[model samples]
Target: MCSISFLVLILFSTNFFLFSLLMLIKDFCMFIEWEVVSFNSCSIVMTFLFDWMSLLFMSFVLLISSLVIYYSKEYMGGDVNINRFIMLVLMFVLSMMLLIISPNLISILLGWDGLGLVSYCLVIYFQNVKSYNAGMLTALSNRIGDVAFLLAIAWMLNYGSWNYIFYLETMKNSIEMEIIGGLIMLAAMTKSAQIPFSSWLPAAMAAPTPVSALVHSSTLVTAGIYLLIRFNILLCDSWMGQVLLLLSGLTMFMAGLGANFEYDLKKIIALSTLSQLGLMMSILSMGFYKLAFFHLLSHALFKALLFMCAGAIIHNMNNSQDIRLMGGLGIYMPLTSGCFNVANLALCGMPFLAGFYSKDLILEIVSLSYINMFSFFLYFFSTGLTVCYSFRLVYYSMTGELNCGSLNMLSDEGWIMLRGMSGLLIMSIIGGSMLSWLIFPTPYMICLPIYLKLLTLFVCISGGLLGYLISNVSLFYFNKSLNNYLVSYFSGSMWFMPYISTYGVINPPLVLGSVVYKSFDQGWSEFMGGQNLYNKLVEYSQLVYFLHNNNLKIYLLLFVLWITFLFSFFFLF
Candidate 1:
């Protein structure tokens, strides 16, 4: 694992530099698609896109994955299945690459499906209940998107080509194109864990930390956003676009609130991821694909680093995941703590960092756009809540009193882990400004009121203050009405999404199945189908035998009795 990771790391670093130079020379260049299957009207082509966007995304995916595989060498040391882990991560990277470069729907589905399947395998690699459940959830949730993709391909059949890039301009107003846009939007939402489908992402924390760092927080979740980025021009002024804008705002707000209430160390990070994804989706809805792409890159860098740091902390804490039991680790593990704080601050969109360059610009864009009051409320509140939870997280795990049982088992120094994190940590710090320069080349012209310009700063400061005060209070004893059973339970369990998806969506069908089995299949079908007919036939046959009379004298008497019986039957009738 270590050797492979190191080799890939060096290879991608070189590739990245070369791509950077090439991008400077040419704005965009696409390879001629190799024809796979040519039909009467359409052909399945395997093509590669090598624009700056795909190149940059692929470079980052490779970089993070290499570090993750390298880090897994130490974190997963002594495990029997460590090799399998590394191989899965490698396959994941391959899938991400395929998704990034593919220009046709067929190849895109190949990549998308690969990611969903491989991630499920990774999630269940632990062979425990939690891993099993999480894997199922993740797989099933993504399956919805896979179906959506297949539907999209079927819909594209009307356009006579699976290469959607060609149709983006001509098909924008066609009614059939609306179906395509809506299906693609639906697919993107599921893959990105938006709204009702979002339960899978945080639950997917059951995967090992390296997997979470490489897959969930970065590549897999961003696949949807990337697809939408490529399809952005088609979505303008469409109903799907408007729906996406609304859903994204709600998703951001929901995930932010969920993060505030979450206690699991990994899950908090995961929920934060969901919120950021919402932000990206919302921005994309507003027709700022470049900004979404920018934030996507920056978030990948820091979120990957953040998860890796969390992995380090969890390793040192003897495999414990509860934040309530963790505190004052900064004193014992300053290096890992420093990385965590850096990532956290970056996540909160701290000044001049990677997130700030993209996030601040995104907020400014939203402010400048003509949007409804509801959307504006969701946008700003989610932004402020981001700061609140970031501070809350830092205080709970890094600054409060040490509650972990023993220091003898804690480990602070792991050179492999630190080395793995170093690459992304550096990227997390400078990726935004670097990409901002490379991507935009020219800055966005901003004309806003002074108050609007300072809103981000004000939101950050106020949220941070509230975060400190809230973290200091006793949450269970805060004595607020929202702490009641229904409200607290709803918020704590992510608005009962687990129940809605598992019990609500899945169990009802199972219950109906049982009913169908017993009532229609077992009872009525059994009696009415074969058995009742056979019993009636047997009874009538037995009675007919008595009337048939075998003896000759008995035959005479039987004939006479039959005549009398016929007379009596007629009279009775």
Candidate 2:
């Protein structure tokens, strides 16, 4: 495990070195005497690594890759194609690094598309048809982002701001700027699986557990949130920014609600991911960039930890992932259950854990946004929904009566998996200290009303207690219809606009092609016209066939003579 992590560190170090070199060349090219040569050289460097944004993204790419590599060595034991899995995972990380660090619009485009491609491959690493279909669905669904990013690249290139620095400096007030912003937001929406793009994420659980942790929790989907944060200056001033906040708030509410009903352990976390992203997006929408980033940092720790724990549970339980099959795990897998319980509590904003500080800030930011009452209600409701579902996650998996599967009656996981969870647990406990200065920078601490902090704690605890009540075994059967209504209809079908926009982009051509193909199978005459023509040709050519067969040698000579005559005729003509 240590060796694997060392290799990942080396991989990131080399990639970062390459990016730094490209950046230096780009800077140098700006002042060289040979104008055309300098310009072309700069363009190449720009296409590689030319911006502060990419540099910022590199930190996340490296951090998450290091953690995941350490994780895989233990999680994927005895799995075939271990080398292939590592290569693909590395490729995914590299693609994200490129996407984040590319200096030119075209390079950014490649990185963007490359991340999508690599993620699709990783999603299907299991070689199961279900995983493959999930990968295909994920790829197809996100193609909407490709269109948007491609358009943004084309627009920027045409505007003479194709380079990263040029784009940041010059494209501010141009009409193309707004177009680019809109395109970028569209891409972010799809990449993050916001609203209508949400289903693909739950489906993506077909991947291996480690992939889910990396993809949903730590890295790939977060890239969109990172994009929004990096461009907050540009987006915050526009209506698009406000729209993102509203959409993000709604996504949080629905995702939280969805998690309430998810029985699958991984899917529950997947929904939590959507909810957490929604919260980050909502905070970002309000121009609280630092606070949003703080939440993002804290979220990465707790969510990744939670997902890793889920992976362990699934692994030990003969690959069973449904929480319904899980209960009393705290008795069996004490270390894992303890780590997960702590993470879950922090995830739902328990006090002192990293999640509390970050989540409360999001609520505060939401309260400050000048949204309508409906939006306000949604935000508040989402807060309650968050507590309820998060508590359910803990109760269903850890605290309930023991109902271990025959395969996982009692077992222990490898040290590598436990190490990842332990690392996250430590981060969760002490990570909030990094932001302590943000809350209390001076020697003298500025204190909020005790009641208010207590109120915040009260709300969180009450929400958790309510969730426990709602998910208690005795009450579960009674909540079935309510659960279906909330998860299936409200969570899944609620994103009418985002859904149409996300799916509509890919559906039209594919649906048209499907219709065209299906028509051929509908028994229409035109569909069978080619077959009829072939049959008629065969019938009419029977005399020719018989004449040829009657004298095979003569026919061969005649055919050769005809071919020679045809070539001679063409040449003469």
Candidate 3:
């Protein structure tokens, strides 16, 4: 199965790269129709991937796709349409490949839309009501981002450089570039789900574990960041760069808070993914593309391992998803539990683990960058929160109560699943420095090993302490609405339209959000304007008919004449 899946994935990926190469060749072979519009008269058509950014992105795409395919076999054993699943997954990978390698705006759009469509299908592949609903919401939210991206691309073509080659070539020209860059940044923020755009991610948890593993951790969620880093030249002078930094920092902060309150295990991971993506965005905004890509690599290894382990837990317990109901099974499922704990610790950036190196690098980048003091504080606070929640995740389901009714059993899944997860965990523990060396050329000593170890230890310990306190404290009970107060006002209530049937201790933001959504969706202006126009038209037509109420015979003659005119008009057509 591993060999077969590898072949399928590699074949599809190779096909996309080869096809893109052919297109590039064809563009080069064609005669140039040069008409001088500005500095250079060049045709807009182009396709090339002979660049560092494209190569790096393609490597990530290929690596993650192959891993997910291998992991999916064991996780999706009994599912029907396995072949179709693999096919769509390959298509999804290909779309992203096209997206990253596209040399022109039009080609990029083609790849972007293709990826989005295939991603939507993968989200809803389960064919259930919940999955379908989540899929629709996911698709709808992404479409909003897609609109912004399309508009930005259109703006780029119209007001800025005519050719993408020239756009890249002349990216340093400050003023004109910033305008285009700002639009792209707006699009990126929406696509990556920074702060206000983050609610859709938790909703997207309804997708299968492999889908969640690949898309949430490594591919779809990171596309925006990739675009930003790839076009760093365009964004250098724009205020959009600073905006991205602030938004990303804010997103990391809020996402940490949201993860703290989520009862569902996957939702917690989903929230954490958002936070991590935010951190990556922050790094990219600071012109730390090397650090951003390195973090991306490490994050993919650990997160995919974490998701697969969550999948095993959910599968073993008859599809139980709530982490609140689980506890104390660490002894029973030692392998799975051990692997999960390692991944979580790495995620929380424990020293000697993978997350420690990558996360510390990000912190270093933040400190060195020209970001504002307030922004720095936000990121630090969020880092503290991340450590808290990551620790909670380790202790809650694996260490605490373990009493998940009758279905709870601490046991490992098939060897295939274990093998996949174990490999990922090992990679996470060591993936950090390898990517760092590959990406970062210069070495600057940032912090002492002792201090780094202490930071990780401190964060993990504090998180555990917080979890213990929350579990024991009666009055200070945890709740998501209060934790994600802002999201409750926007995505959780407005976009989701959750019905409020009960009223005890309701969250104010959610309540206000629901009311606002109703007002907008059922507003009077739209109905009244259309109704009034239609009524006036009908009334005038009736009045005109009434004025001609002279004779039925005359009316019949006029109708016959009108039919003749219609026939003549048809004959002319």
Candidate 4:
């Protein structure tokens, strides 16, 4: 079943790629509308827009998803519910496709909600306490975005159509449109895991690695970026865009810093995904939507490869995910290590690789743009930090002395998994260049000072050096994290994001819920509603029973009083 799914996805991906190329060359777009219902003057229509951007993104998603599924056949071969896992993944892919094609807000909502619902199921697939918590965090965080989309849809109702594409140009300067744009930005922020919404991205690593590779790296998180790209016109010169710029910059910096302190392999990659997402959002907010899209596509290729490599290592390591316990893996798993390092280097924007094409262009553009010091520093420093953590990851996982038990054996003999990764490995090496040439028909003319041009290189080298030196151990070395526990804890714990997102966001509501339950459901509501009504009914029934129980003394007294009152009334008249 997995094999068949893989082939079908690959075939569709190839066709989509071809269609995208044709659309790009011809500069053509097709919109198909199917009317579902009509009332007097109103019509409900489902719309699908076929353009170069959507086609290209769909191709990338399908390609990555197919490979991930093929990889899963080996990674999850031992699991009893492997078939169910594949089905869930396929559903996720279908939802992403729906999202990619739909141009109408209502149709988009269907896809949007589908992504969130399916992702929650996938996240809790393992059915453990940790997985359940992660799933809840993932679901609730995404729910914010879902609500935002719904609001955007409702806001669009005033415009007389749900087809946002029809209004993008005319609504750019409208105040009402700005509200919709802000809601869309909020939606994108949550979906992409920017700022406060970011805690779920790392937590979602509780899911299977294949899901991480497919969902986190490309489809689910990138959905927001794509939506924003579609709605870019409304963001131009808007206050919401400015706010997004600041928030996304901070998000990028925060993810990089947090990844440096993290030890979990999947979590590290997850944070890296968040960092890249920030980069894309910041660029989009700056009105460079095409650049953002370019980075999104390029990032997806290598990031997926990175996750797959991490999965292979984890699989061989007997499900252990801590980087600290892994060492000298390059010797035993050379192929996996090679692919891992390639993906890592690509992530750091090494020249001529998939990431360099998009990342270097983005940096060059940022350097030339007029921006404040804070945004500028965030861009370059985050770039450096990306290199820092990536190299740090590479050092600990691949270069150090073997730290595992001597009796344990490790090999790169998972041929199926390797084959799956190999497909992405080739793409990671070439995908960026291919995407850049295809997406940007006209080259951007970037003019910048030599120092600024080299700034990225300088930070990358320094970051790489710092990353290696920081992780290197010597005879006299002491654990700095242990010595400065507070600092380490703060940084390592994602700057307390898990607490903020879970306990902090949840605690207040939970407390309110408890109070409501005690005061209302269990207290006044019960008393006034069911209990009070019951008591009154019971008292009335008792009186009636007493009156009918043949109580002769009470009846005689009542009759005598009535007769005396009547006689007194007659005499007075």
Q: What is the TM-score of each candidate against the true structure?
A: 0.89, 0.79, 0.76, 0.95
For model 1, the stretches where C-alpha displacement exceeds 4 angstroms are 36-44, 475-485, 518-573
lDDT of 3 by residue, 192-295 (tens): 88766666677778888988888876678878787777677765545766888888888887787767666789988888898899899887887777678778
Name the 10 consecutive residues with the lowest summed lDDT in model 4. 473-482
- The digit string of per-residue lDDT tens for model 2 on 404-467 reads 5355455665788887677668877877665544333442223556664455566777788888
> Which residue runs does candidate 2 get wrong by more than 4 Å?
5-43, 47-57, 168-170, 405-408, 435-455, 473-512, 515-573
Error of 4 at 411 (Å): 1.0
What are the Cα lDDT values of the candidates?
0.87, 0.73, 0.72, 0.91
What TM-score would you give candidate 3 relative to the actual structure?
0.76
**Top model number, TM-score:** 4
Q: Which stretches of candidate 4 lie over 4 Å from their true place?
A: 37-43, 473-476, 545-569
Kindly give the stretch of ten consecutive residues in candidate 3 with the minimal lDDT sum.
Answer: 496-505
Off by over 4 Å in 3: 1-3, 8-46, 158-165, 169-175, 406-410, 447-461, 472-573
- What RMSD does each model have against the real structure? 5.2, 7.6, 9.2, 2.0
lDDT of 4: 0.91
- Clash list (residue pairs), candidate 4: none
Candidate 1, 381-464: lDDT as tens digits: 999999998998998898867786655455567998998888888888888888888888888888899999999889988988
